[model samples]
Target: MKILVCIKQVPDMESRFRPNGEKTWYDESDLAFRMNEYDEYAVEQAVQLKEQLGGEPEITVLSIGPERTVEAIKKALAMGGDRAVHIRDDRYYQKDPWQIASMIASYAKGEGFDLIFTGMQSQDRGSAQVGVIVAELLGVSCATTLVGFSYDGGTITVKRELEGGIKGVAKLKLPALVTCQLGLNTPRYPTLPNIMKAKKKEIASLTAAELTGEAELTATAAIYPPAKKGGGLVLEGEIGAQVDRLMGILKEKTAVLR
Candidate 1:
């Protein structure tokens, strides 16, 4: 079996982020980057499937970003990905979901992969659109928010969570794509030996020009953080009066408060 896992390198959420002077993107100076938290789950699922398949399933991790993105790919290799492919373009951030998905689909078109996996959403933009778009572009079956997965011969069964704790199960034919959410499986960490071995693994590099020619679907007009939240109200009165005021506030917030 062959599996293709799409991973992304994102700015660490813990970093102090401030828009650059142009108000386009964060000032990346001295910022540390890592594989996106959500995508890590996808990588873990791919590696786990490969290990379970027992017949040396081919797993290739793919990503799009600048040259530094190779570090994130290396992390996936240490976790057991067979190899990696990097789509190098310093302006990846400027591209929209359609453009990004088009680039991935372009490379994936000729590659005969049985399955493709990606994070449900990216941490930075939280667009949650690339995986589905890729699936559509590739003209394959697609599933999202996958929590349960199993493979049998040429078909795979997957379960996804719906609202109100409902689970949806479906059987997808081969050459399908899925966007994995958390809680599917506990992601394993890389060991010292695996980290050393990852250095020797293959990481094929490519450029955006070599992939596809698609214009960005959306443009960022400006960027700003949310405004500061309002301070809480203090009820200064006797117990009975405070209770009455609290009831009024709750009533305004919710109809059941009455």
Candidate 2:
């Protein structure tokens, strides 16, 4: 069983982020990058699947980003993917969901992959939409919020997380797309030995412009995330008065104050 895992490199959320001078993008100078948090879980799922399948199932890690993204791929390799492919292009810095999905789908077609995996969302953007869009472009079935799975021959059973503590069990044929959720499995840390091994693994580089003749990416305007709101309000007053004022505030916020 061959599996392809789409990973993403993102600015580490732990770093202090500042907006660009025009407030159009993040300040890159002081930022540290890492594998997108959700994608790390996706990588973990792929590794676990390979371990259970009793053979390393040709797990290829894919990413679209700048040259620095190689670091992210190396992390996945240190965790145990068979190989890594990076789509290098400056446009990836400005790629929207549609562009990213189209590019990935174009590359995956005819790759003869049995399964495709992605993290549920990228932490920096948190749009949570690309995996489905890519699956659509690839003309394959996709399931998201996956928590667990069981494979039987060519049939794959997956556990999907739903609303209010509900979970749905689904079965899909081979060559399906899965967006992994946290709690699927624990991601492994790279030991010093594996880190050394990763340094010797070859990372293949491909350019987005050369990737199977997909449509040129649409231009997008850069926009940084809105500044986070400050800490919550702390109400203080006599108990009864506090309750009444809290009710009034809540009502006003909910537009039920009338």
Candidate 3:
């Protein structure tokens, strides 16, 4: 089976984020980066599936980002991916979900992949929409937050985690998309030997325009995050007096009443 897993490089969760000069996104100067945590589960799942199937599955990790993303992809390789494709686009920093999905779908459309795996969401954006969008674009079956999976003869069965003590299971044909959830498996650490081998693995790079054959972004702008504010407190008073005082404050501040 040929498995394709989508991965992402995001700011290290430990960093303290602050807004750039603009008020739309965070400044990244002091931040470090790591692979998206959930995508790591997806990678581990693909590797385990290949082992159980008794065939050398060609597992390819795909990412859309800047040069730093190579480090993240290498981490996957160190764990157990056959190769990687890095869509090295500077504009990837500001891409919305639609554009990101479009690029991945465009590249994966005819790759003869038996299964496509992705994380539930990216750590940086947390927009849990890419896998569904990519599945829609490819016109394939999709299962999200899959915790367990097994294959029989030619059909693949998946177990998904859901809310309120509900879990879902389904079977699908060769070509399918699945987004993995946490607790699917404990990801193994990369041994020193595997890390050395991973460094030698080839990481192929492609441009966004090259992949899409046309420039898709309208224009790239400097992104920044919103400002922080101090917390407010409610003062103690009698219930009736508090009600009257709150109404007066609202009226004075908002001009709700003259």
Candidate 4:
């Protein structure tokens, strides 16, 4: 079996962040980067599946980020990924999920992987669209937010987490994609020897220009913090006047019965 896991490097959640002068993004100068939280689960799931299969189930990890992001790739390799590919971009800071997915799919389409795994969503953007988009680009079946997975007779069965505490079960043919959700499995720490071995392993590097041919589908317009929520309304009038004002407010909100 051949598996590919996609991951991202993101700012540490505990760090304090400040918007840039344009209020469009953060000042990353003092930020620390780490492997995206959910993708860690995906990596663990892939490695565990590989171990269970035991007959050289090739596991490769792919990541898109600046040079500093290679650290996360190394961590995945140390966690038992057979190899890794890094799409390094120091100047590209835009967050376009479709473009990223396209780049990955372009590179991976020729790899003939049997399964592809990615986090349900990236920590920074939380778009939750990249994995499914990649599947579409590759023309493969897809399942998202999978908390349980297994393979038998060339069929991949998975349990997905859905709204209202419901678990959705799906069976997909080989050569599919799935976005991993949290609580699926605990990620294993890279032992010292494995970490050392990972340092010697090779990581292939590629640029977006090499992997993609088409331009991105969308572009950013502007970004600003959401408006502060308003406090509840206070009525300071006679009972009838207050009642009338309340009714008017409700009507404005379209909350009143017609």
Q: Return the candidate ranking by lDDT, descending.
A: 1, 4, 3, 2
* Models ranked on TM-score: 1, 4, 2, 3
lDDT of 1 by residue, 1-258 (tens): 878999999999998888878787777787999999878999999998888888478899999999889999999999999989999999888888899999999999999888999999999988999999999999999999998988888788999989998999999998899999889888889999999999999999999999878887798888887786876897896999999999999999988866
Residue 94 accuracy (lDDT) in model 3: 65
lDDT of each: 0.91, 0.84, 0.85, 0.89
Per-residue C-alpha lDDT of model 4 across residues 199-239, encoded as one tens digit per residue: 98889999877877667677766666567698688899799
Q: How do all models score by TM-score?
A: 0.87, 0.82, 0.82, 0.85
Clashes of 1: 0
**Residue 134 accuracy (lDDT) in model 3:** 93
Residue 79, model 2: Cα distance from true site in angstroms: 0.8
Q: Can you give the lDDT of residue 165 in candidate 3?
A: 58
Q: Which tens-of-lDDT digit does each residue in 1-258 have in candidate 3?
A: 899999999998878887666544677788998989999999998898888878578899999988888989999999899899999987675677778899999999888788899999998888799999999999988888888877776678889999985889899887889898888788888899999999988888888886664344443465444554765657587999888888888888886676
- Please tell me which model should have the higher lDDT, number 2 or number 4: 4
Per model, how many backbone clashes are there? 0, 0, 3, 0
Report the poorest 10 consecutive residues by lDDT, candidate 4: 88-97
Give stretches of model 2 more than 4 Å off. Answer: 21-23, 212-258
How far is 208's C-alpha from truth in model 3 (Å)?
Answer: 0.9
Candidate 2, lDDT over the whole model: 0.84
